[model samples]
Target chain A: MAPAVLIEKLQKRYGKVEAVKDVSFQVEPGEIFGLLGPNGAGKTTTIRCICTLATPDAGKIEVSSINAIANPKAARQKLGYVAQEVALDKVLTGRELLQLQAALYHIPGKFAKERIDKMISSLGLQEYADQKTGTYSGGIRKRLDLAAGLLHKPDVLVLDEPTVGLDIESRVVMWDILRQLRDAGTTVLLTSHYLEEVDALASSVAIIDKGVVIAAGTPSELKDRVGGDRITLRIREFCPLEEAEKAKDMLKSFPFVQEAIINVAQGNSLNLVVTPQSDALITIQQALQAAGLPTFGIAQSRPSLDDVYLAATGRTLMDAELAAAGSRDPKAERKQNMK
Target chain B: MSSTVTPSKPNVSLKPEAMQVSPAPGFFGELVQETLALTRRLFIQLQRRPSTLIAGVIQPLIWLVLFGALFQNAPKGLFGDTVNYGQFLAAGVIVFTAFSGALNAGLPVMFDREFGFLNRLLVAPLASRYSIVFASAIFIITLSAIQTSAIIAASAFLGAGWPDPLGLGLISLILLLLVLGVTALSLGLAFALPGHIELIAVIFVTNLPLLFASTALAPLSFMPRWLQMIATLNPLSYAIEPIRYLYLNSDWALNSVVMQAPWGAVTLGGALLVLLVLDVVAFFIIQPLLRRTFA
Candidate 1:
């Protein structure tokens, strides 16, 4: 009856770094909820707090009506966490690792064996199940890690960056498994920086930036929030700032073109928001031709999650990723995650 | 597609599950199950990669053989009326081997922590987190037993006579007590320290110093006043002296005076009591560290 997971006003600080600050979201039962953010945006920290791996400085995290903070043991029993890093012991075989996981979640020996076998087969790890995980490829390791996380079939499954470093095939597999888990009545929560991963898989998304939730809605609802068709137009492949400004001003003059901004990080490209008009692209091309400006490239489509993010944060997700990457302290982050 | 049939619904409520899993076992039952499983994993690792075990036994045998021979030509009364140094050195070697092996018990756990393997264990619905520590203790104590056996076997072959059955059993008891204490500290260090490199540094600085200061290689009389004070205070000394006394005299009693520390003579019973106290103190000291980590 309570939401599968309710994290209200969550705050976590690691020494001087406020890893997660003032985050709130509710995940409905049997739904796949995505916490979408860039690196160092506190998604993992938030997951850690929810899964009871790290204590939140302040928050209410209830997993299936259990208070995760006040009663971590009971909450942990109801939650399965697949950490961002695949934390399998290299020496352990896939089956052995799952067995260990089953026991930790207190799956009785008889039931554990049955579940382990079924999970290994369902996860497509039968061939590698008995082999030491050290010999596994990245994809295989991720599969095993997923199986281990799901062995207990917790009511709420929490995953942190489930496919950050995985290959395309593996990523697709991971997504499929997540959907299957949801269809089978498991409430799934995942954090990721990949827009498409979230857009394609997550039923609803919470966009977080700098440890704050800037937006929360279904993927299409978020896409609809910006309320216009997106037009990304590049002049001369790399337009000059003045030319980009001129193009922005020209585009803004049209009644249909409600908003225009120059994307400085993308070679001074012009990003526009226009009311849905069938010939918006053609009209833009004609305007460029009449102005004697060469149109290097142009495309138009419905606003995506990136546009939603940009509208709310004043920058694209890629831009935020680059900025966050530059200022990140890997050493300190490692220490925080290790804790 | 079967998967794409369900579109993203912004306001749709998720229906509860039609079928739920059967409930888990009671707390203590689950705790025992998990602990045994974790301990079994450690043993399986040891079984597959027997290098640590092989090296553990071999290193002490080397010390017993080579180090015992190093002083084979010492004066007859040099090691206190023992016909040979091997006889006197057996207890020290056995206790020191157990101590050294126990000191490194935290390495596996430290590696687990460093590589994020410990995070896997931590996130589980473990009944008690201390089961992690308990599993490590069980593994390390088993290893100490194996290594102790190897050392004792090698010494007996080198003309260091074996103690009577009761003496042999007492030797095991003393080593078990010592191992429990040291293993607790090592596991505490595993959690308290940042990484394996620092843990190894602590172990490197600690291993030999504790041995040297504990009358492992030489008797208490061989040390200067300050060194004697340190060696007397060392817990390893308590274990080593009791076992050494048992080996020397077939007629040993629990109250037999084994060594005369700077303070006074400590009987065999007194030595065992000291080791027991050391075990208690070591565990007491590490409780807070474990709490901070497992919290």
Candidate 2:
């Protein structure tokens, strides 16, 4: 059987902005696939093309072996999309909104009622189901949007930033529910900028930057490809630049320490990538003490998804997010998203 | 954590290949189902928040009463023999109310577009996206009917005599034709325009101008020659003249002269035909636009 979802060489442009340029990925059945990237990295644009909400200027998109461009209705039947913005009508009760979703998907009347009831119960929305959605909390609204997307039990469920604004408790609940859906044989695809969210939930991830897929693999695999243990050492609460440089120079003499750089933004703390070894942390602490630079705090761990992103893009995801934020035009972005 | 638990139906896999494929339903059945589903949503919105409906009905009633009182003592027999200005204004108000209501039909659709709710609908497995347009037309036409009734009742209360049974039938026909045509145009604008702001701007500029240019407030003869020609050409006049003629004469025939245009005299039957043609033309005119977006 073909993969549940396949996108090859996907290209989309909004005027001069090449929102998605040459994106490609395949989602295996019953796996949680993640599109991980910073804001303005074309994650949402890629999701839009897959869900048939926006036509791609080029490339092929297929859902369950059906060409999205040629047979969009068929692809729509197989795919369910939950957008980043919860587009619920303020006047509609949660139940009414689900009913509308059921009808739009052409669910049989008998099955629709049962499915909507199951969704309301599963999402723990029974209490709020009768109230207008305008009165719902953010968490409850996202849950309702999720229930609406799942009402049809689509073959591939596509979500764009599903837990962007949820509280920790709700975010946990959403992750559990997504895992449950995957176990039940639904191919789940989601896009998010939260590295930990993807690290915890996604079985396989694609890290995209500026509309290109920089790295794609299982979280552990990608992290292992970076091939180092990260060590963060702060010489002082707010170390002087000279003190940070002294620590960096002292730490670099160790054969296990592959690279060390002072992160000026974090009070000149040293961020080190050391060759994996059992006692790398203790040796680094001893080296700092010998240099007469006190270690305020130090921690060591295997490379994380964030490290993989940093290794690939030469900047942390947070830094990329800040950079993208300053350059983004809210009006132009809203216009791009409007249609 | 009982990962070893086996299903009773071991062969019943959840994969797509295990699913049975059934033949899709016939075209008309699917169309009707989808259209009804969409129309039901609009009705539910109208029911839950009856403000728009209430305001729609009340506004036209106020126009009929206040406007009728404005010209209550106009020169007798000036409008026509035995036809008071109030009586003459009733048909115009009814047509104008429906026309205006139909003109604003695109607002909800435009809002849907702006809020990304339309994207939700577009991504669904709809049988035909035209059902979206059809649902809007049904809702707007129903709304115009309610507003038209309010105008009819208000006119009757203001001593504007009621149309005979046959006249009422003719009036309903004309209103439906005009509503269908205008609703199509409004929905077309909803899809053709970029956003709600642009759509509202167009409606704002077009509404009062179309009302003034038509025979809604005054007779064609009262206007300058150029304005009279424009009024005759306005589709609103085609709807208004027939109903106005019906109210004035109980024994009116289909071919009775209703409007004296600059070009020639248009009979009641000819006015009805124009509305019918307008409906057909408007539907075809928006076909390509709807297809480009919906297809």
Candidate 3:
């Protein structure tokens, strides 16, 4: 069977800015695939192209073997898109908005009514159904938006930054709902910059940056490819640079230690990458004790998705996000997204 | 409470053979549905928060009563031969109300665009995006009709004479044509302009000037040569004159003369034709612009 969604070599540009370039990924049936990137990394553009909201300058995007660009209407029938922003008409009640959504998707009248009720109940929106959306809280509004997207039960559901700006409880609720959706045989594709969000929910992920797909694999697979356990060691609570360097040099002599760098930003602590071994932390402690260095703190863990991003891009996601934020022109970006 | 029974296997309803769900072909029917749905949304909004509609109706009624009184003391024949100044001013108020209402048709759509609500409609499987344009047109025209009726009723209550039966029908027809044309132009700008602020700025600058320049406030014959030329060329003048003539002459026919343009005399039939042509031209001009943003 063909994948639920197939995008190959997608390219999109907003004037001189290449929003998406040379991006390709496939989402398997009954799986949650994530596009992980910083804010300006073109994940939204890629999803927009797949949903046929914006025309791509070049690329092949398909939904259930139907070409999205050539037969957008058919592809649209097979795909449900929940945009980043919840664009509900404030004047419309939650139930009324769902009814409108049902009509737009051409659901059969009887089935539409049943499905709408089911969605409203399942999403815990029954009490708010008759109230205008303007009166809804952010979480309630997002739940309604999700209900509207799922009214047609398309084969694949695409979400952009699904949990952004939500309170912790709402985010947890959204995650549980997404898991239920995946278990019920719906394919899910989502874009998110939150590391923990993708790490926890996505079965597989593609890390995109500067409009290009830099890495793609299962979460564990990508993490394993980076191949190291991280250890942060501080000789003193706030060590001098020279003492941190001495500790780093001594730690580098260990056979399991692959690399060591002093993190001056954290008061001259040493961050070390060690080959995964049971006694690596013990070995580092021994070395520090021999040097008459008092161990202020020490911790060790397997590499995380952030490490995967850091290894691939040579910069942390946070750094890249700040850089991208400073360079973005809000006015131009708003214009590009308007249509 | 009803968790008593567990079956041998999870109950899975036999799926009906997947019904072929597809959008209708061609843009017309889909456009109709979307337009109707959008227009229905506007009416629902009006039904719930009717402050704008209330203001629209009340403002004109006040203008008809108060402004008419301000001119009540003027010479009787100074405005026209047999028509009172109040009667002459009634047609201008009616035309002005419709024009102003139609001019504002873009405001809601522009707000939708600015607030990101438009993206919701665009992402749907719309057969043609032109449904957005059609919806705005329908909503604006319906609103113009409501405002026009209120103004007409208020003017009549203020002792301004009512038009004959045929004249009333003609008045509605003219209002429809004029509203259609102006609504098209306004909706076009809603798509072309960057934001609601820019669109509202344009509307503000153009609104009162167009009203003053047209025959809505004063007849072309009463204006200076330059002002008369400008008023004659204004499309609002074309709408106002025919309705004004119907109010002033009970026996008026299609061939009855409404105004003398700089170059020629415009009859009632000629003015109606001009409005029809203007509607066609306005839609034609906006076709490419709408296609660019919508398609």
Candidate 4:
């Protein structure tokens, strides 16, 4: 069977700004694929192209073998999209909104009724079905929007930031629902800025930045490829820079240690990259103790997705997020979204 | 937060074969389904929040009673050979109400675009996106009818007398043509303008100027040469004059002169033809805009 969604060299530009530049990825059937990036990283733009909301300047998009760019209507039939912002008509009750969604997909009346009820119950929206969406909380509104997107039963369900504003409980519930969707053989493609969201749910992920894909793989494979277990140790909670540097220099000479750096932002904590071994942390502790450096705290864990991003971009995801937030022009972005 | 509320096999029933469970309903059937669905959404909104409709009806009735009374004491033949100023002003108010209401048809669409709800419709595999255009036209025309009926009833009560049944039917046709043409232009603006703020700005500057330029409040003969020329050229004047002719004349026909413009006499048939031309031209002007957005 063909890949559920294939986008090649996808390029989309709004005015002088290239929102998506050379993005390419493939999502196989029955797996949760994630496009992980910070804001303004072209994640939403790529999803728009797949959903037929915007035309890409240069690209080929295929949805289950249909050329999405050339034949969007057929592709649209096979794909379901839940937008980043839940665009519900607040005046409409949840049930009425679902009926409108059902009609748009040209679902048969009887089948649509059955499908809508199933979606409502599955999303746990039975009690809120008859109330106006304006009266719903953010969590309930999102669930209703999800039901609307799934009512047509598309082959691929594409969501952009599915849990951006939800509370922790709602976010976890959303994750559970998505896992169930994939288990039922629906190809799921989502974009999210939350590291944990993708790490916990996506079987495969592509990390994008500045409109380009820099890394793509399963989460564990990416962690393994980065080649180290991380050890964070602080000689003192607010260790002097010279003492932290001394600790880092001593830790670097160990046979199992791959790299060591002093993290000044974390009060001069020493971060070490080491080859996987049970005694690596003990060796570092022993070296610190022999050098008369006091140990305030110490912890060891496997490399995380953030480490992969840091390795590829040399900047942490949090740093990239803050930078993106400062530079984005609200007026220009709203104009692009309107069209 | 409990997992029990979450179904383990939520989409299990959503086998791909469910789509094949129903045969294709054919193109026209799909078109009607989507159009009616869209149109139904608008009606549901109107039903739940009736303020706009209530204001629409009341505003026109106020114009009929208050504006007519303001000019009540004018000499009987000063405006025309009509029995009263109310009679002469009745046609203007009817046409103006429809024109203003139709001019605002794009506001909802513009709001939808701004709020991102339009993306929901665009993402759907619609049979034809023109169904969006169709739904707006149908809703606006129906609204114009309701407003027109309310004004006509108020005018009759204020002693302006009713048009014949055939005259009522013709009045509906005239409003339909005017509403459709204005609605097309408004929707074009909704798509072309950047946001609802700009669209509303355009509507604000357009509404009163067009009313003044047309023969809505005054007759062509009463205006000076330049103003008369502008009023005769105004499409709203064509809509107003024919309905005024139907109201004041008991034995009217297609050939009966409705207005004596500065150029020449414009008969009832000629006026209707102008509205038809305006409709065709409006559609042509917005065709490219629609294609750009829809594509």
Residues A1-339, candidate 4, lDDT per residue (tens digit)?
789999899999999999999899999998999999889899999999999999999989999999999899999999899999998999999999999999999998888888788888787787889989998877778788888888888889999999999877678778888988887789999999999999999999999999999999999999999988999998998999999888888787888888888888899998888899999878888888899988899999999898999999998899999999999998998888886
Q: List ranges where model 2 is wrong by over 4 Å.
A: B1-23
lDDT of 2 by residue, A107-154 (tens): 777777877887888777777899999898777788788889888778
In candidate 1, position A100 carries an lDDT of: 85
Mark the 10 consecutive residues where model 3 chain B has the least summed lDDT.
Answer: B1-10
By TM-score, the better pick of 1 and 2 is 2
Q: After superposition, how far is residue B175 of candidate 2 from its true place, in Å?
A: 0.6
DockQ of each: 0.40, 0.35, 0.33, 0.54
Candidate 3 regions with alpha-carbon error over 4 angstroms:
A234-242, A264-268, B1-32
Candidate 1, residues B17-80, lDDT tens digits: the string is: 2323557567788789889999999998998899988988888788888998899899898898
Cα lDDT of all candidates, in order?
0.87, 0.86, 0.84, 0.89
The full ranking of all candidates by DockQ, starting with the best, is 4, 1, 2, 3
User: Residue B98, candidate 1: how far off, in angstroms?
Assistant: 0.2
Q: Estimate each model's TM-score.
A: 0.94, 0.95, 0.94, 0.96
Candidate 2 clash pair list? none
Q: Between the candidate structures 1 and 4, which one is better when assessed by lDDT?
A: 4
Where is the poorest 10-residue window by lDDT in model 4 chain B?
Answer: B1-10
i-RMS, each model, one decimal: 7.2, 7.6, 6.8, 3.0
Q: lDDT tens digits, residues A103-220, model 3?
A: 6765655677887887888787877899999998777788889888887787898999999988776777788788878877889999999999999999999999999999999999
Q: Tally clashing residue pairs in candidate 4.
A: 0
Residue B12, candidate 1: C-alpha displacement in angstroms? 23
Across residues B1-295, which tens digit of lDDT does each residue of candidate 4 receive? 2333532333334555545466789899999999999999999999999887788888878888888989889888877757888998899899888988999999899999988999999999999999999999888888888888888888888888988989888988988999989999999999999988899899999888999998878777788999999999999999999998888877889999998988999999999999999999999999999998887
- Backbone clash pairs for candidate 3 read none
